[model samples]
Target: MTTLKKDSLLKGTLILALAALVARMLGMFQKIPLDYILDAEGQYAFLAANNIYLLLLVIATAGFPSAISKMVSERMETGRYEEAKRIYKASLVFGAVSGLLLSSLLYFLAPMYATDVVKKESITLAVQAIAPALILFPIIAMMRGYFQGRQMMSAGGISQIVEQFARVIIGLGLGILFLSLGYSDTVSAAAVTFGSVFGSIAAFAVMVYYARKLKKQDARLAVHSSAEARAALQPNLPYATNSSMKLKFRAIYSEILKMSIPALITSMTINLVYMFDTSFFISITEQVYTDERATEAFAALGTKAQSLAGIPPILAIALGSSIIPIVAAAFARKDQAEVNKQTSMVLKIVCLTGVPVALFLTASAYSVTGMLFASPTGYETVAMLCAGTILQITMMTSNSILYGMGKQKQTMVNTIIGLIGKIVFSTLCGYYFGVAGFIIGSTICFLIVTLLNLRLIKRDVTLHVMGKKWIPYLGAVVVSAAACWGAEYVMLNITEGIAEKLSYLLTVLVSGSILCAIYGILLLKLNIITAQDVEALPGKLRGPMRKVMRVLRAGQSG
Candidate 1:
């Protein structure tokens, strides 16, 4: 990969990462108010509606973003800039129309899922309340796809921050207002969920603002292009008097769907598993526990634990989003070396940033949960689910690689296998082992998909992701987990007599440090992070990290 592309990937990843970080933190905070104000029953209604909407939203939007990104990036790379813009327009039109159709579907099906599945009609209102967001969000998603394709990530990042801020602020305030007015949990849920509509509006405004600016920039760049370059893009078609070439929009739409259907399946399958975890819980657990008890437990396991579990995978998602354009461009050029180089770097980067956070969350799950929630259930479940996200990251990264390479059918098949495995395991495990078993079952399937993808990648394009460092990499993960767990255990014993929130808060804050430090030491000692990896880091981070590396190596040598 060229230095410029590498730098673009890092910049894009960092921008998206920071956006995800803030959004996730706000999401976590949003949960706190939901927990305290709305209580367990309210949480169930909100999450049920929200989770169902997410599954459908994935169905609505997933097909377009990566497809558009891949198409746009490839076209832009070859300087077929007009073709790229047409792809965006095609996607935006399809997405807007589909978003509206699906929004209506969700609105109509609200009662079916709410009453039949969730056993609460109030959730129907909740489901319908946020449905309109789908109308505009799909368009926003296409805009993000276009920006990412152009390697202009800050637009998407800014939109995410703005969208999430709107959701959290409006969602929580409305919930509080409804509750204070003696409204039923039903009214509160719908009120809170309406925040999504506001968020969508905010995101739409932001994307539009960026889109206009990008158009101006592109127009400026296009003035310098020669007629020869424009003619080359479409050798069969005559260039216009202004050196512009026309594209067949129908063919472009066909190409997009061919790419997007599989892309949709591959990208949204993991989230399907996530949604299934919540959706299947009531029916499965109702057999073992009472309906009311099961509802409360769902809030604990499904809402609380799952929300916290979601934090670490943001890096994987951001990195995956950032890499698709780069990988797609390389694949288009038939640059196998660059593809492999990029594939290796993405996996390695996932390990560097994602692993330690997963381990820390796993080790300190109880402490973290204790600090956040008054409920005593789901403490161990949180740890297991958080650890499970490591597997989730592996699957996500590998799946994105296949998606970017346009291995559409293979990626689709492998991801569906994983999703089916999740459903089957979740049922059997939830039947026998109870609430936490759902996470375990889903995680086990993620591993199956991860291994399958590794095999496929090797068969197709031979990227030995960890290469010979598999042992040390595995060793680093194991050692970091052990150290964090041990330190948290010791901290727990020391802080046992204090308040639940304060004691666990202390344990989490302190033991989390041990996890990071131990992981850092292992990275230096085991050479798991190569010199090239350091050089690939963004400029602002690279200098500080080099200084740290030198100091650590000097101490080790002494």
Candidate 2:
């Protein structure tokens, strides 16, 4: 295959971020229907099973994909195409075997885990239903990493959309059908969980189709290589000769394990915190409240509050994933200037997006939570969680930078330290304060990790955060927060004629839009986003943004 131009950081981030936003929207829509279908107890069960599924899935695949991506990119940088191909092939085998084995373990152990460990026998079906998806996800992850390593995000992004779309459609359909048929809540939840399996299958199909097409393209290019060069760079020579492929596999696997184990641990840090909550939050609450109340509290915190809070960080996650390969390539070339530039750009974008989102969501937390979930019970928790989004975005971006800079072990250490803190804080606070305690604990944990990461970045790269550079973003946040709060207050006072739910919806929608406009204007007026920044926008947006910037600039000059 012809080597494509390396994707610029802005273009790559925008591509993945847009895809992530779409996927996140679909996910949010799915949750609305799910919350409607599953009562508090059922939602608790669903989240219980899902938390375990995610934790296991992260353990099985997270590290290898990242490791493969980094390794492949590093090799490709040196024009060692054959080595990169070998790494890809080896990772595919490893992913398939590990996925199958771990999936089997989960499927069989679901009963014990639900009944014995989590003390929730009702989640057995849900856990078992999601087990099959585990088998497909790792393989899919490997393919995504392959494309991401090549700095081609289209395949991965498209597959994510296809996956989430299929999951929502099939999962929701099955769930509704089961409920309509008068099935038990457990059975209905199980049916919904099966959606993950279908989604993974659909995603796998897309990735495979793309993989085969790319393989053929690469094969045609391979024919052009000279015979001597081909012989010297035989990636699959062991298969052709008397040498055992097992030995080659062993070597590749060892190298992958060395590189990936730390990443795996680092990746698991967030999920580990979730699992900690899943294990402790309800159990601790049960000591002070009835089982039913405990379950309701867990559902509110895990399902409603955490889910709503997660939306803002979708961009950060995408930005994090996209930067790994870009930064890695720059580091490979010893391009310190490019590394610093990319790092600074990513931080600015994260703060610009994340700060406003955190502020607006926190300001309008009750309305947003009520509008989305039909209840504002967890509004305070959601507000606190939303307040933590800035830290989450910063932590994710910094972690990715460290991972790309070949500091995976250091990142892992930082995550471990943070995870330990989370466990300690969550355990103590959850036992004492229930849902509010968990939110506070989580927010504090994120702060700890983000601060650690920032310190490390400064020490390693001599990266400086100038107050002048961030003042505009902070100003924008202040302005947006004030606007949203004012709009929300006005809507509350004037919308007495409207239905309560309708009023909440209107308050959020109207206030959110006004807040966005105000934020954008403040950003321009403060000169936070320059003409050059507008030029870097996607082709369709650039022209309009440029015109707006021109008018704004003219006004300033006049």
Candidate 3:
């Protein structure tokens, strides 16, 4: 095999982020059609079932991928390819057993879970339909984790695109077909849920193909290495024996679990919060509204608004995912400087992207919701949720940094505290304030978690993120958001009766574009992002950044 160069951490992150963006778009599109096809009742059922599926899925596999990636990278850094391969093999076994067992449990208990837990009998079929995907997804996650450990991100990226593509085509196609065939809404929704199974299978095939190709290359490299070693009379060198291999496997397994369990609990926090909403929101809303109205409210807040609000945070997720292995490798080398540098850069980028997106979403909630989801029913909820998005993005990046530094236990503790806050706030707020209350609860939960994680990260590393320098960035976002809000207000008033939907779309598109441009210009002018920052961007982004810098310079010179 050709010797692999160390991947540029930023480039790897950008690749994953681009793929994540596409996947998130596909996910949003899937929801739009599904929401249209199924009424609010069906959408509620689907989302309720999905929450259960996500919780189980996270419990089964979320942490292993990051743990495997970190472990594999650490081993590879020391030239222990064989050990890394052993770690991968052991993880596959663990993934298969756990995935199948959990999948079986979900499949068998779908009725009870839907009825007793979610209090929605109509969701049972959807839960069952998604169960098989859980099995395949965990295995696929392990494969992706292995590749990520090797710093070969293309396999994971390609598989993600393929998976999302297959999901959109198959899911929407099947849902429409089933609806056309006059199936019950539950059945039609279940058909859409099957798309997860098909998508996971597609993703699995892609990963397997890549794995086989990699194995061939590794085999050739191994043969060449053996020949060279023999020729060099390296007979006394340390080589893996069967007994030693068993000991190594034991060590790897223990370490894997040690690293993965806390991470698993930390990841499960988000799903747990969602599960809380699903179980409580509808019932709580029914106290104030009719059952039908409650279902609509649930669909608006939990399904439509939640999905739309989640789009911007994909950047943070991608950044966090990429940070794990990169920071892990740096930490393994005891390079505190590199670790701090990567952590700070990741935090800065998250803030720079997150703050503006949060402010824009909050400011343009009505128009954006109208344009994206065909109505602004839950615009207030979405606006509130955007605050949580910023907090959650920052918290996720912080958690990744902690995980990289082997601080999963502390992160898990913080997540548990946040989870408690979520349960208490969501329940209390939902009972009194309905959907808006759930949104507020979520914001509080994320804020608590983020602040706690930030404190821990500060103690762990010399991170200087969001310092005095970030004030200008915040100022730019605030000014731009205010300008966009004014522009939107004018546009809405001017286009009131001619075409409401068209007006909303135009207001959002035009205002969003102009304001974002203004924000970028202000960031440049305020020196919030200097030339060094522009140069630090990936090559593709650096050119545009440089052009912005040039414009700023010209404005100053003139």
Candidate 4:
């Protein structure tokens, strides 16, 4: 039974990790063709429009899904199955009503939002196009919360993949078609905005199917039980209650709202930072540029650059989301050791993932940006943006960990500092350096917030966890930088044509791979990853790591 439980958890974590990888890859790859179709100007309009919609989506669904998942899990644990259903149903209704209100407001106010706030008349149409997605997206969230609450993650995985893929595919196709037909870039941008609505529709359909199937299975199980067994097995359905369904719905909705409001506030604050940046930066850039067309084009450059820099957040969300449930469960069991262990592992994994990604991005920024965009401005801006990832990943991970440890107020305080730092630095830098300033400001914000949180975590958690692990991580990163530089030199000197790109990729891969391998071997040889460490790795990863041991043995023998 213990083994079975362990295996299930490993599988779940693996699934989450794999899904996250796919989502991140999809998000990054989506930009390749988009850069070609829209140019940076069109991208700016699209980004501007999409950022607003994204913020709205967060407001509508931010904390509800996670909170609802936790609530349902508790109810199910106590065998209150009917209560779980009522809660879920109530949540869905609330999502629908809220989505409608938000979507309508945004859609109708698009012109004001675009012209008055963003200072881009082009964005007005794009806002209208994306408005429908605001309505559909929350329903998808509700169903996802329901399934996720039941500890069924596969459906969530499938829906997220499909939703993202559909958006990319449809958006790209329509953007190309509109552009080819000689529509203005602004119109083409609006078409791309509308594609998300279609994607959400498809995703919502799938979630509904899954929810219904789950319900039917539960019904069948209830029916098959004998009278006495049925009584034992039956969930507490509120159907027999004397109260009207409407009253019951209202009560459930109230409960969900109480849990979700704080989440909404938190999410709104976080998302609002980006919205504020987009609106003000784009408006100010437009004012600085003078020419309407030039302003549009320049704004798009900043938008695209921001998008490229955002890849780290995608991975962070995946890791952070999975971490929360595990931490929460550990907390429920009052297992301090498990909580600390998981927290440490998450931090290590974040560094392990973030350091290499950021280094590679920084090292290959020019080639990567060149490959993705036609304009030199786009390339330069994205390269600048790429530089921010190192700080962003570290800060983001630390903040997530703070939240996991139940340090909400501290998290808010740290976030406010970061946001304030971003605004001040961004304004100053943007005035002087234009697009580069934004990314630099972002990096500064990340560094400051991360350090602040690190201090808090050390004080609160009763351990000097950050100081112990961070030194080695930084050392490894510095070594990686040297290795990547050396590898780049070799690739440029020795490789040609397809051979050139392939060789550069391989050399870079090898350089980072070797650095990581050496780091691990040193950690093991120095007693970092001891026998206990080997035992702690997931079963699949453990077997392959044994080969590392064998290779080390052969090296010693030789």
Candidate 5:
């Protein structure tokens, strides 16, 4: 294994982060082609089905994965390796049963949600076509989470990327074929939706292979476990034993619910807010404009803009995934210093990487939207939305850190507050500016969560991430944002003569290159990112980042 791909938390986070980036980028590219194949109404139907499917997916994969990882990490840290395995087994059984029940519920209830809530009965086929994926994915999620708990991230990371890879390839291929056959856009949407089934199958196969290997590894660990370790778990015999299996399982499920439910609620926070955007924004906009206009607006803001916005959170999501188990293990060992170190690093990395990207995306929102969708329908909304994610992504990182520290209750409370804030803000904002206002309101809600998390984190870990390096970090972001505007000013005069999407595409390429170059140089010259930080990056990124820093340092010396 590569040194940077070792089982350290930072390494694991990098692996998962890169994998998620690939998967999400594939999903994004998948949308670009689907947007071309499907017209306005077709895009709406396609997105509606996927939204419902994704929210339900949050139910399936979100909470249990984090919870399983945390619980298993805690158990293993305490040297109850066997009980850690039991936690995995118990969660598996729960996943199988829950997955089946939820899958059927989704299949049967598709028509109601598509017609009644989304107000588009045509999306029913699209929704129902992907329902079967839920049946197996819950189990797959369980295994992936279990692997993560063991710090074997490559298995889960590769499986998730492969899953999305399959989804994109199948969805695109089938979608193109159906369109060539002169089928309805409705049929194309359904074909795209069916890709989830293939994705789940591919993912399940990968998970099975990894699960088998991990099981063999687990057996070896058990054999080598100390006597004291064995005795600690002896009291709660394996569920395979008939004697106390039933009682032990009762406790196991109870534990699962205890952690998973809150984690589910917390994990669902972002998706739930987006769900509000879909139904709530549509409902609000319909009152203000014609049904067709509202639907068109929804398509722009919800589908195209949101897809682009999803890219920035990749690091936060990866950190959240990798952080919980590592923090939980440290907490289990009562390592306060490690917790503080990790908690501080989370915000530092977010500030270093996330802030600059958010600014660039905001500045070039039109270019990005135009480049991707071949239209800039919701450019303004997306611009502000991308900026607002600075708050949202930070909140997500803190929430995960709190959850890892076994503060599920606090995180749940924070989410609940954010949800309420989001609903109120979106409604009020929608009243003022139409669909664009909703994102503003949700951004406010995210601010609420971020503040709450900061308070709690300060109380718990005694962290002050901003004290020492705040100036350089702020300088890098400010200078880079200014560079973007400067480039924007110049590109405006030049690119106006080019075609619409092509002009914007060129602008994105040129401006993005300039902005990143300035940002990277400033990050090194100002010491916002150090050599150690670059060293911590995965092998692929490490080399490039080091070269940037080296060139900058050498330039300064010369």
Candidate 6:
């Protein structure tokens, strides 16, 4: 690709990444009030049902979009533009039909699925509440994937924002309105689920607008082509003579299912860890705590604790998504040096970003949870989850890197081992410490997986990611922890009410930022990110950094 083209591509990807980050921020803020608005049990029911819906969406749409995009891009690369257009059109229709069928089946079977397979009585009501949303969600996922495949990320970004915004506005607002009128939490949870359906509908509308625009563009392009060209580009019309349309649909179904299986396995293996943990944690906690207050706290802890520990995982997703394509392309070209450099740099950035955040959370778990949740019922849970966040970030990045390097089977094995470890440890911990055990189990699993990935990296990739680099990371953690603790103490003395809450949050944020700056400088002082590294940021940022010496000179004269 030309430099300009590559730059444009990078810019688009960066924009999408930023959009995802902002959307996540919005999602968290949206959930914060919802958690308060509905209370623990209500939030649990809503999240529980939504989790099932998410799993189904991932399964149904896992590899279809990526595979579709890859196919289209490959066709375009080979100069078969008309054929690519035909493939895109076929994929769109296929996605819509399949999404509809899948959603219908799941929506109808939701109660049975929850009661029989999940075996949760509480989940039954929530599942029924979320059923319609599940039904409509697949179509939205497909549209999202289709756009992503077409490299039209802006449409996907807008759709995501629109979807989440609708969920927050309609779900939270209506639920709060109902609560003010004396609706029970259970009913509010149900309303929240219904809101999800409306949110998906809104996203679908936005997607249709973009899809139609794409269709217009495609039609304009088609007008320039000869009739013979269009005719030649069409597939053999698939089963011309006696074959029914059902056969064609079935063929499309089979194709999507075949590709989706691996992608499903890959996606599920990654997500199942959390889903099973969710069930296991809730079950184990209910067993340990017969008291209603304790049980409620246990259930709520899962949300608040997970929320507290979620920052690293959120940031890791961004790093992982960016790194995967880069690593995949490098592997494709057999460019070992570039692969090694990119992998190492990405890993460092991940650690540099995650460690301090995790440390800050660990140091101020109680204050952080109190600030967000208006209660300290699960402070211990928050701390344990905070530790897990660190392990999760490390393992996710390393395992993702391995997967990108074409070690899918090894990555699968690592996940299986981690899952097994999580189940056993979580069970034991729950027996010993109740709900807190769930977070402990999570931390244990990620630690196991991180070690496994390290072994793989050493044996297969010749990288030393575990020595001096880790030592510095530890130092940064210590620095961040001290900073947060000190900040917490000082902020607590000078603030009250909303200002106190804001002050505590600002302290945490500032503490984390300072630690990152110190970590980066320490790395440079220790020759990690050196003079050359400063020059490698995006052009816009690099220009400002390059003028630092001039600014320093002017400052000295002043």
TM-score of each: 0.84, 0.85, 0.86, 0.82, 0.84, 0.82
Model 2 stretches astray by more than 4 angstroms: 1-23, 56-62, 70-93, 143-156, 211-247, 329-335, 464-466, 469-476, 517-558
CA displacement after TM-score superposition, residue 217 of candidate 5 (Å): 7.8
Residue lDDT tens for model 2, 39-151: 87678777876676556545534676666777777866665666777778887887798789978998899888877767777888888999889897878888887877876
Q: lDDT score of model 2?
A: 0.77
Candidate 4 local lDDT, 229-274, one digit each (tens)? 4344433221222332433887777766666664555445435656
| Residue pairs with clashing backbones, model 1 | none
Candidate 5 residue runs with Cα over 4 Å from true position: 1-15, 69-92, 146-152, 211-248, 322-341, 468-479, 498-502, 517-558
Candidate No. with top lDDT: 3
lDDT of 1 by residue, 59-161 (tens): 5335766677778888766667668777888878877887889789888987887778656666778888988888987788788877777777788788888
Model 1 sits at a Cα RMSD from the real structure of 5.1
For all candidates in order, the CA lDDT equals 0.77, 0.77, 0.78, 0.66, 0.78, 0.65
Off by over 4 Å in 3: 1-19, 55-62, 70-90, 149-151, 214-253, 325-342, 469-475, 524-527, 539-558
Give the clash count for model 5: 0
- The reply for model 4, stretches above 4 Å from the true place, is 1-21, 56-62, 79-82, 227-251, 262-273, 286-304, 313-315, 375-380, 460-473, 489-535, 543-558
lDDT tens digits, residue span 1-558, model 3: 343323456766676777767876776667776656888878877787667655654543367776788888887666565677788998888778878997899899989877776667888898899888888777887887888787777788789889888877997789889999999888888888788789888989999988898776555545656755532432212234233343266787788788888988887776777788888766666677777787788888766677867776877878777888788899999998998889988998888887778878888888888777757777887788876788888777888899888788999999989888888888888888888888878888888999999899888588866567767777887799898888888888888887778999889987888788888888778887778777879899999878868977998989
lDDT of 5 by residue, 457-498 (tens): 888696856567777777878888888877866786798987
How well is each residue in 186-230 modelled by candidate 6, as lDDT tens digits?
Answer: 777777666777777887899888877766645643666565654
C-alpha root-mean-square deviation, candidate 5: 5.0
Counting clashing residue pairs in each candidate, in order, gives: 0, 0, 0, 1, 0, 0
TM-score of 2: 0.85
Model 6, residue 334: displacement in angstroms? 1.8
